[model samples]
Target: MAGVQDQLEIKFRLTDGSDIGPKSFPTAASVATLKETVLAQWPKEKENGPRTVKDVKLISAGRILENSRTIGECRSPLCDVPGGVTTMHVVVQPPSTEKDKKAAHLPKQNKCVCVIL
Candidate 1:
């Protein structure tokens, strides 16, 4: 068994357009469980809608993660799943940007600015 500190620290983007990180959980944690954790941190909730874990890509040490065929593979210690390192980079894009009232109705455009994050 792995200790609390031994657990892998998974960091990934959530569907709600936020960056979550350093989530310490056992390697056996399911994708569904991770999804729930993401939802818990979500700013808002939808009454009825379809949610799927699509485009699930793993990233580690500035490289894209491969060979993650199963939940176990995703949490494998042999892989980059410890030391507070991020092994996945998830892009969560919701159908509607209604939550972003400031830019909800704005057209899609790029701005020239530096985001610290």
Candidate 2:
């Protein structure tokens, strides 16, 4: 049987400098699952919260956590102290609109387009 040492304590650090938890989770839990938990536990008072799981991004040790990766796999020695709680930054980015998408695909021009008469 897995003991307490097998579990990890994690807290999500919001952009507003608030935290969601120091909740204990099994190492087997997936990052996607954690995102779902974040969505569920998100503060009702906070504005511009994530509307979907895809909108949530978890960053640890300066790297974004992949949904397919398990919590155990995502553990960073730099952030995950043996008995201390690990704090991961949560970034909520809304899905890009068509306008934003179009702009992203637009080619960058090196020369100035302005012509003086």
Candidate 3:
């Protein structure tokens, strides 16, 4: 058998429902770089949101992506709709840890968490 290696186009959709086309880069491009590219293309108004790329997290195929890692199993909903203001459907997840629960101020400590991706 032969090994097949090819490049894939990664597209990022902002929280404002704006789509950034796939950029041609090696699959090894870091998540941080991808974020930077996405932010550059994002509308000015949307960039003023409370959260920036540093505060936001990226996940693909059930695994949290690291800043140094490349895109794999890429999926949509990378950027979350802050404060439930957008028409886009989102899933909301409860706090997962005691600290998170305390911060969110949930009445219970051990409740199952819901994660909106």
Candidate 4:
């Protein structure tokens, strides 16, 4: 109870309208730490979930928080309202494998051609 002043209530809102937490965290916690927590508590039923922390991205106050940034550094009037739960949007993008990477460079199947005389 004594350290509550430095704690922040945060919850992650997934793209599917699901949430991960409304948990308390010290202001010193890093964004990377939050990502790990997300990975640990990720919804088991969700499809195409992130396989690692690198795949998780957190957005708060309309800004994409960097992994090196701390929670205290992210406090803003737009999202970190006093005594209110801060909702951070979570985006999961799985790392691309060799096959996917190669396919991405390939040309598209359909192309439009136009010529004017």
Q: lDDT: which candidate is best?
A: 2
lDDT of 3 by residue, 5-33 (tens): 33445555445556557455454567777
**Which regions in candidate 1 have their CA more than 4 angstroms from the true location?**
1-6, 14-18, 44-71, 76-81, 93-117
- Best-fitting candidate, scored by TM-score: 2
RMSD of each: 11.1, 2.9, 12.3, 2.9
lDDT score for residue 2 of model 1: 45
Worst 10 residues of 4 by lDDT: 75-84
Quote the lDDT for 17 in model 4: 92
| Residue lDDT tens for model 1, 1-101 | 34755466776654454566656766566666665565555445534223544434344444544432434545444556346565455544455555788
Task: State in Å the error of residue 85, model 2.
Answer: 0.7
The 0-to-1 C-alpha lDDT of every candidate, in the order given, reads: 0.53, 0.93, 0.48, 0.91
Clashing pairs in 4: none
lDDT of 2: 0.93
User: Candidate 4 overall Cα lDDT vs. reference?
Assistant: 0.91
Pairs in steric clash, model 3? 91-116, 93-114, 93-115, 94-114
